[model samples]
Target chain A: MQIQTKAVNGVLTLSLDEKRLDSKLAVGFKDKVGELIASGNRLIVFNLSAVDFIDSSGIGCLVTCLKLMGPKGKITIWGLKPPVESMFKLTRMDRVFTLCSTEEQALQAVNS
Target chain B: MNQVSLTIDSRPENVPLVGACAKEIAGQSFSIDKLSEIEQALVETVNNCIEHAYCGSEDRQITIKYALSKDRLFVEITDQGKGLDPQCLKKLTAELDYNPSDIDCLPEGGFGLNVINSCMDEVNYRREDGKNHWSLTKFVVPLT
Candidate 1:
């Protein structure tokens, strides 16, 4: 559950530096991201560039983060690998969450 | 046909280890995306067994077997725990329900089996002799 955090244009961008966002680290991942959200970061760009896999639990974890962020808060997930993208598609999360293909798009999404 | 079998305690951390094994075994049989899908499906299955079947009881054992033929790969998981309810399995087989608009209405879990069902070409579940069994199959295009 290692995350590299950077701030751009007053938006927080957290890059996940892991290979899989599965059951093993789902809870910790959620809590860490939630903590950032709680600490007054309303707009977030989650970089998943290095992540190759996401299970249902991991998907659920992201959903929980969205809820934790509330209505005014937005979290954009970008840099989805092919498999990561497919999980979003299969679960139809692509419709609910803001999924971006690049860091610029992610930053733009959260900023908007 | 070639087959491999291994066992692990019903721990959440162990699921990915098994998943990685499946990916390695899949090798050139599937594309990188397909391999990732298979690994996700396998991880979902084992997570279900660890949570629903074993009730998060880390002391229990889960056995996973991988068998590969010329055209398909099969994964079977066995656990000495409670079997899934028929109603639940039916829902997972038939439904992919979720709220696409309201974040408040979204579900936090219960989509594991649905992912498995969607990723793999075939999925089956049964209970025999007090053990729960889950069988998953994926059609592969082996590389030359």
Candidate 2:
């Protein structure tokens, strides 16, 4: 699940270079997040500009990451395509995480 | 009215392929805005068929039928696996509420059926002739 990772002032930003984050990649996505958490990354940001489609399994993988982060840490997602945003709202996940528009905004959301 | 059918092995990898076909057919009948929703609904149903019905066992066949009327697109997906639980609908249709304050309370999965219901105009499930059947309907409109 080749994800692009960047560290900015202790916060890590992970970007999945995939168009569709469906069931096929769900396990790998969750595993990656688990690894990040295990590696002492508490504050994390995800850039999802390239992902235009996300199914329920994708959503579940994201929620699993959030849970892994726990209350002490923060996870912000930015660059949601229309369909992905619609899925976030449809599943009422918008209330759980701050959905940002840009990478800077997401980094700032997670950093602060 | 136009109808088309496609069959694929019960695997997670094949879900997006079927979703793409659904979007292509939906494009002719529905506006562009509804394409993702239509595809999402169909994908969820297919995933359920593979996960719950077929129990993630590959090699089994999952059949999908797409029919287009004047203003509506009907999609029916069938699988020769186990039948869906009758009590599942009540759980899937309930309000998708979560407690952000409690991380454990937040649901990590089980959004498939709920998402399908949210996207499509109608979603139904049935069992007949030793097969599990799931149907989805969407009403289309002009592009503008």
Q: A42-104 in candidate 2: lDDT tens per residue?
A: 898999999989988998888888878767778899999999999999888888889999988
Clashing pairs in 1: none
lDDT of 2 at B115: 88
Q: Which ten residues in a row have the lowest lDDT in candidate 1 chain B?
A: B90-99
Q: Which of the numbered candidates is closest to the native, going by highest TM-score?
A: 2
lDDT of 2 by residue, B1-144 (tens): 989999999989898888889877767677666888898888989998898988999999999999988889999999999887898987558887677667789888888888888888988888899998888999877557
Candidate 1 lDDT, B28-59, residue by residue in tens: 68887788778878888889998999888999
CA shift of A31, model 2, Å: 1.1
**Model 1 Cα displacement at B68 (Å)?**
0.9
| Per-prediction interface RMSD in Å | 1.1, 1.1
